[model samples]
Target: MNKFIKLAAAAAVAMSTGTAAWAADYNLTISSWTGPNHGINALMWPGLIEMIEEATDGKVTAEVKLGLAPPPAQMDLVMDGAADMTIIFHGYQPGRFVGTKLIELPGYEGNAEAASVAYWRVYEEHLAALDEHRGVKVMGLSTHGPGQIHSNKEVTSIADLDGLKTRLPGGVASDIGRELGMIGIQVPAPKVYETLASDAADAVAMPYEGRVGFKLTEVAENVYEMPGGFYRGSFAFLMSQETFDSLPEDLQKALDEKVFGEPASRMLGQAWDEIDRIGREATVEAESNTITIASEQDQMLYGQYADLITKQVLAELNAAGIDAEAAYEMVKAEMAAQ
Candidate 1:
């Protein structure tokens, strides 16, 4: 009788352990602008995935699907549930992103790491509860890197841009060119290299990352460093409301713990900083090119130009009945506080 009772107890314990193990399995799908072959895929994406998997004790594993479509298609794909989640830039959407403009304030930031984490925190504390983001669950909101201009022509001063046709996607790049005296053309990003190489445009205004992705150095050599990332744009990772709602509660909790809450800023910032570095390297390695960058004096003038555009932004913000003064003040105060 004692032996039979011991056997029964062991069987009950094994069955309970099996049941717990069965409850642990979770699966997810993810995608991003950086195609599967990019370093960002090799580095940041996998690192984030590993963090989630480990945090959930291997209960959750992600299958990352990259390069499924162009950048413009990302937001739509997530919304339609064609993708589980993705990273998207609002600049691609134009006037549709009016509410998120508070983040794009010029020269208004602290340490990007803390600023980014704070951005997510603030958005959740304030913006997330609103109807604006009801269709998607935002993982984070951040503008990742400082930017500079790489062009075929030297932009030593604002005058150098006169009549120079440049490739700019939209938002502040178009606004800055107009503010500073250049004639700008709005074109799809994939066509930028073709435009410049074929002489449709004399230059392009973009952050350094594209230099590597598009092999930018072969066609453009002169680089103008516009620090504080004047033209840098914001991006966010998001999940479809329906997809998120469909997840099992425990799996959803695992995601919140893994991707939400807070991640070391290093995980996010490193990918952005790498783009700038790689962009510069591509320019440097290009054959027979003179890089005429902005000096501190030139940068000072650029600062004034940046400020002037801020006024323009404020004007536009006010016309739409958005009182950006306090938010603007908060941004400046945060930058100063840093």
Candidate 2:
């Protein structure tokens, strides 16, 4: 009788295991500031979610809420239960991401997509385990492919940049802009057109190509390709700790497998390429958009800018108890590896 009862229990356990192998419920929410239908997130990230949904055979799904709210409030919104996940600027919380080696460390003049892939791969191996991201769960972090200045007037030399009230995407970019003698204006992206029309801004900094709705072609005539970029601004997708903890284990695994892994190459790389392509079209069509490739002298001068700014940034990071130099080296190492 005892043996029969034990056999019955073992059979039940086997049946449960087999059932588990079939399918299971897995669902999560992803809240984003950019419309899922367009922009950087759309350009690169959708395929990841779609792949996950299909791979799970509809047992798992990702619900994306794109452009649900303004970005400044996004971090708090996720923390407050208004959103389960969203992307926010690391620079927005100044000093928090310092020493992580990413935000605005110059000498990134070559390739954005290459740098982005390399950045994430290194961060996953080193930084994530280092408490660099303490309170938040980082889904992914990457930058706009690269930035260039599109302006009404040609910025041929240092003298050409003086007194131009340009639209600056605040933080390091604005700081650099002011340092370069432009009166920096901070207008939200949506207000750019009106600001340009009203003469509140003389120019805007945007990618070299492939911005959909921002309409750089309509307002700016000359594009000044800053050698080191005004700032290599980066964006991060994050989820509330509470929200992530509430998910079942299978769902978490699903999200990681379907979305975060090698998909970055597909999502981020492709989008930036598209944007870069589109930029070429806009520049040509505008007919007025002039590309001023930095001369040897200009390039030589930018090296001085890189030295000063990189030192200050590293000094500031070191003061806060991080190996800023190490982080900087990691970025360069990754770039060189490629």
lDDT of 2 by residue, 239-335 (tens): 7778667766776686677666445543665556566666656576666567777777876776676677778777776676656677777777776
What is every candidate's alpha-carbon RMSD to the true fold?
11.4, 12.4
Model 1: which ten-residue window has the lowest total lDDT? 11-20
lDDT of 1 by residue, 281-300 (tens): 65676666555666788778
Best by lDDT: 1
Deviation from native of the Cα of residue 188 in model 1, angstroms: 4.1
TM for every model, in the order presented, reads: 0.80, 0.80
TM-score of 2: 0.80
Full-model lDDT, candidate 2: 0.62
- Regions of model 1 farther than 4 Å from truth: 1-24, 37-40, 109-115, 125-131, 264-266, 285-290, 315-323, 332-338
